[model samples]
Target: MKKIFVYGSLMSGLDTDGNMNGAKLVHADCRTLHKYAMYIYEDYPFIFEGRSNYQIKGELYEVPADVLKHLDAYEGDFYFRKLAEIECGEETVSAFVYFGRGHFFGMKEVKGGDYRAFRGKDGN
Candidate 1:
């Protein structure tokens, strides 16, 4: 099973069509080991490693090889897929996380580290 961590629109209920169509959700409270900052750009969310105490709220999904390829194609140049160890409840598992590789300037930071909450904001 190919495990992946999704922090933004890829999470369940966020994407209407469902990015993880054939995948199974493994954990609902997956978080990154390292700190990172998240911002909303063009109504979408991006997370980059930097000076922030935010743990990056997301979910862990176990997908098939075919599903992984589809996700890679969907992300494209928007992000760089990297291996990361995420904390899932009492266990720490290695999963693939997409780090934003594009230039983001003056983007609004999602203070709570949760994309869903950010989307619920007034101007979001």
Candidate 2:
């Protein structure tokens, strides 16, 4: 199994979360050790390195090899998968994170790291 950090739709309790079927939850409400930029691409959220602003808030999961392979295909070629450190509770651990690549265009950056809150799912 591989540890994967998800900050967008694959997060638990969100649309496309079913893509994580068969994966075990490692942690919830976790943040990245390093900061990154997050923006809304269409209706979905995507993040990239540089211009660090916020430590992304998301979840961690232990996914099987098959599932990880599936995720790679699911994420397509635009999102690059890489290992990164994240704050899971009080411990920092390394996990596979997908960094999205695309044109910024008219994308709006999210102030807070939480995508749910940005989407108004948390009623914030």
Candidate 3:
């Protein structure tokens, strides 16, 4: 099983149109870890390495290897997946994280690093 971390549209329970549907996702749970920063890129959130202190919150889902291809296609050229370690409860698990490739200069950073909470406050 391949474990992947989704913080933006693909985050489970988010009412976004880009969410992965019909994908057999399992062992899903919310988790937070360090070493990245999330920003409002266009209409959604984009995360990339370059910041510290802020812990990124997202859902970790276990899926089949083939699911990665679908996710890649769903993510499109704007994102590329990479392996990253995240804090799940008391343990750290290495999972695939999507890093945005599009330009995000001058965009507002999601200070809390929690997309859901950011959406609730800013309506994105």
* Whole-model lDDT values for every prediction: 0.83, 0.89, 0.73
Number of the top-ranking candidate, with TM-score as the measure: 2
Give all TM-scores, in the order shown.
0.88, 0.94, 0.81
lDDT of 3 by residue, 20-116 (tens): 5545554444555666777886677888777674678877877676677888887888788888888877788888888878655777888878887
Instruction: Estimate, for each residue in 32-54, the C-alpha lDDT of model 1 and write its tens digit.
Output: 88778888888677788656759
RMSD of model 1 against the true structure: 3.1
Residues 10-78 of candidate 2 have per-residue lDDT tens digits of: 888888888999999988879999999898878778888876989999999999999999999999987
State how far residue 80 of model 3 sits from its true place (Å).
1.4
**Model 3 pairs whose backbones collide:** none
Q: Model 3, 119: alpha-carbon shift in Å? A: 0.7
> What's the candidate order when arranged by decreasing TM-score?
2, 1, 3
Better of 1 and 3 by lDDT: 1
Better of 1 and 2 by lDDT: 2
10 residues in a row with least lDDT, candidate 3: 17-26
Between candidates 1 and 2, the TM-score winner: 2
